[model samples]
Target: MFDVAGLWHGFQIAATPVNLMWGLIGCALGTAVGVLPGLGPAATIALLLPISMKMGSPVTAIILMSGIFYGAMYGGSTTSILLKIPGEAASVVTCIDGYEMAKSGRAGAALGVAAIGSFIAGTIGLIGLTMMAPPLAEAALKFGPSEYFSLTVLGLLLATYLTGESALKGLTMAIVGLILGCMGLDPLSGAVRFDFGVADLQSNLDFVTLAMGLFGVGEILYSLEKSGTASILTTRIENVFPKLADLTRSGWSMVRGSVIGFLVGILPGGGAVLSSLISYAVEKKASKHPEEFGHGAIEGVAGPESANNAAASSSFIPLLTLGIPGNASTAMIFAALLIHGITPGPFLLKEHADVFWGVVASMYIGNVMLLILNLPLIGIWVQLLRVPYSFLAPLIMVLTLVGVYSVNNNVFDIWVMLVMGVFGYVARKLKFDLGPLLLAFVLGPIMERSLRQALLMSNGDGSVFFTRPISGSLMAIAIAFVLYNLWAARKKNRAARAVASSEAAK
Candidate 1:
């Protein structure tokens, strides 16, 4: 069971002057990058990982990192509303309704609603974190490799489905990612695989290098190929708060989004991006005014904004409790913990309660800070957007290169990053989503290792996954999801055929 007293003690520690200062710095920096398109929290955290290790103790460092995570979630809404560009991937859905709202001169209301919704969602997610993480960790203590493997499978399926594209494309990208994950030395055997005789290849791919290139560089390439810049705002900005009617209309949407996002965020492959998309979809499906979705529906802005923030907060659960990186940003956080000589796992609550609870408590404080920071500074953010894209592009490119090279001091890593950038661009042009690719790449090695260990323990009995109670349930769920999708596809096709036949008869 979770101890509320322990979490309260954590707030006391996080409130210290130094930790609070670190939190403020992180929020400020995170907001700056997040308001700029293509710069995300993962790259920022990866860039700061080396610095965090040396800045202070692990507790203070993680407080800073967690601050950046939630801050980016809040800040991502800025460019989404004003420029119709997603400052982060999770903000993609926001661009639809948010930009529409801005076009109608309700940009401030959209921004205000996003901030308020995010604050509420973050608070809800934090309460869930305080109550749920410990119990989940305790339950996870009983899990073996088979159970972990099955859970990952289920997570991958759910992630693929929620991306709002054809599942076939998502699954294909995942297969490609799995192949990529097989690179580097065989952990169990002494032999190297897929090295192609290159000395640097023997070490396998660096997660940071791959993440930065595929997301950062790939985005730049894709965006550059598209002609035209974001529509610059020239109108006078006013009204920084939502009207009472706006609040009343979006209240339920916010509540539902918060709940859905937190649940999805607990799964291994889930994150803010998926949460936002699904929240937007649900709003469209359930709305009486469904036709208003892309034309500046407040439900569109409220649901996704709330969902992404909640999802961002809840995505930390698997990382803190199970020692698994739930998504890309958490993967970077996992790397940071390893740098600080702390292993996050089942014992995390028992052994490193301070670090665990302190980080959680700081999120509460950080969310408040983000609300305060974003509301008053909407004008500043809009003005910052006036800086030419030509100027920002070069600066971003230089920063990406410097951030990758600073930690490892390896030239090979630079080459790897560029190669991934090209690969990512090609894949995107082919209509493939990078979410599955990256998630699969990160989880592939873990899945392989888990299966091997489980087989070893079971002495080659392949049924171990099906025989185990928890693992079996998870595997069943995955199978059912596939079947359900197939059934739905057939039904949709049949409906199309019936409509065509009716037209011919007429």
Candidate 2:
């Protein structure tokens, strides 16, 4: 299923001057966003949706977008090492040992290990993607409406269980997202639903508008509340190359992180952030000197950094093959495809092989580009960190406003974005996980259409989902996950009550 000829052709497409220029731009912008605290790749991609779409070439646009995805994983470690600030959520663990290493005069070594590990891990993940995606897409071609419906159900359930601490809250958010997804014209009947006499609501609430509001403006508002002084280490970095001994010690850690990251990244909600956290824990558990963790251990920085980048690389699998966006960044990429009238699914490889292979090849090039940028351009990122958040925040707001307005040229969409921004701000303050919400929102219409079509085919029989072999297996798995989540939640609640009673007695 892996085609050498196709890969070579992809490289040819990716290596063109125009594609290379856009890819470089995306990598640079991604790195800058990663080095900045408030801006994220998801939000940046969402903000740039209009601009990328206007380029009129989906392959070039996706190559640029994919570069930003993995490039952020590399750039995130800079602030973690230098200032104890995580520029990206996935880099949070790096702040522990990375900052400690900086204080211990090993900042350059830490950064070096992180960059090298990321490159290696990204390569590993890319290899996995190259091998796995085509076969999976072939298999998915056999999926019918029942199978599709069941798969979406399984995805939503897994996302609810894996992405959030509270399954109830996650499910609640997912339900809300489903309702929102239904708030437009019915795809099959073209009958207006949930418009409530508002004309803008008839066509449908814009996904780009909602995404920009929730991620871009919402993050800015939240960051404003928590803005404070960042303590930058004055330690001068020297020798960015790791010692041979250190490399030997961290070699297995990077490999383990790569494997872990790639496997986990295939899961619906287990993205770069979750993969990095899991990798750090695994490294800590596997290390002989576990106590050295959080106190300048090189493995601490190596494993998580590698894992995050690997996860970023692998997360595109579902988006390309199954048309399922595994994380927010990929979800934005999914939106980009839709903007170009390209539906991402089983037939995408057959129809748009250029977009698929070109993006993958570009990722290979982008990973190398990031390694070079991170190693030699540390000072550039450090200088970027000095730009006041005050200035950056307002500038982001203006961009958000301008970008959202440019979408449909409707002032009503701007108001919708502001309302969603407030909702996102409140959701964050209340500790609600937004991942499931967004994922459900994206999957809702798909699920609805699949279910309706399945019912029509079955002549209104619901058992068709359980009667088919593939759909039956998927439905069974979804049921198992739901039961497991409920049982786990119950156990957790019981434990919390027991601890509370014991403390009260004491």
Candidate 3:
């Protein structure tokens, strides 16, 4: 049975006036950041880390930040549906049918379905969080260094699979991220690995600086490369509510998406982006009119949008329960918890029940709040797209600069942002996925630490990784995935060659 008393206590804390206010502010700021072309949830949370530290209790700070996290997931779709540009990786699927819907003059319906579906998925995710978290936390207590290392390996393999186009490219980017992660002081020896004697290099590349530069500044530069200005100028606001037929069509799609998203979200380093892609693929495969997917299919818009948001919400489980962050935003949230002197792990449920349950409760409230706020204000958000690029672009640039500078009060971060922006543009042009890179950056340290610990525990034996049952199983799965992926690639190449020969014969 659910613990009613614990939930009641959580509601009491989350309902406080100050906490509620922070949640609202976070939601609004997150929405604004998401609406902007370049900024993402990770950048926004990292930028605000300094401010969050100076503010209220850990629970309240997290409440505020969580609002921003989930809100951005919701808000990213708005721009994607309105413009062809995706606000973030998680919103990429939204652009497929969402923009098509806008072009077909059903933008209102698309937006409506997105908001409603997100709300429903968010609620379901919270329910899963509330019920499943404690048991998972208990289970995580048994995870040793070997198990953790295996998990990280699995996570990297999953990243490779999720990366579009080529697994080799994803592996290359992940290796690059791991190398970049090694620039700082070694955790075990306290020795510098890649520092060139510069004081900033001594502390290593800041995650905030790297992320802000790559996603924020880099995105802006890419946008500048496009010829001519673009703006959201459409004034046709139809009914904000989904029609009865539209609801009937998308109801099951939403359920399927939520289930898949929640399960994927539980995996370390898998979150909204992977969930959205998987949901879209599943929806397309199951659709009665699969051909309609890229041409304004309602299921395309509804399914992926819901999946992304639900995945965003459920990702908190590992972070709060096992002290393992599944994504960059969750990593930032973990940083916030550490800053506030809270160590999240197996004991958190018993020791910090208020914080855990309060966060869960707030998510429920936040979902309801988002629906109420977004549905009626869809017109306002659409109008926001009408702002001239000349004005909006520079403002985004300035915000990016300020956000980078705010972290550690360092001007070096601004320079890093500029370099990263250029690199990001190049990567985008080369069709490299940034998702794998970001995940690698976040998981690199954990993987390193876990591997070292496991080796030490086994007297420096390399076979320790395969000695444990759980660890061995995970590694076996990862190996299978790699082999399968390679086999599939070869098969695809052969098929393509056969097609070319047939064309030549014709």
TM-score of 1: 0.90
The candidates, ranked best first by lDDT, are 2, 1, 3
For model 2, the run of ten residues with the poorest summed lDDT: 226-235
Candidate 3 Cα misplacement greater than 4 A, ranges? 99-105, 233-235, 284-296, 339-352
* Model 3 C-alpha lDDT versus the unseen true structure: 0.81
Comparing candidate 2 with candidate 3, which one achieves the higher TM-score? 2
Model 3: ten consecutive residues of lowest lDDT? 226-235
lDDT of each: 0.84, 0.89, 0.81
- How would you encode candidate 1's per-residue C-alpha lDDT over 243-335 as one tens digit per residue? 999999999999989998898887765678888989999999989999999999999999999999999888888888877776767877776
Backbone clashes, each candidate: 0, 0, 1
List per-candidate RMSD values in Å: 2.9, 1.2, 2.8
Give per-residue lDDT, candidate 1, residue 173.
Answer: 81
TM-score, every prediction: 0.90, 0.98, 0.90
Q: Which residue segments of model 1 deviate by more than 4 Å? A: 47-56, 268-270, 281-297, 493-506
- Which candidate leads in TM-score? 2
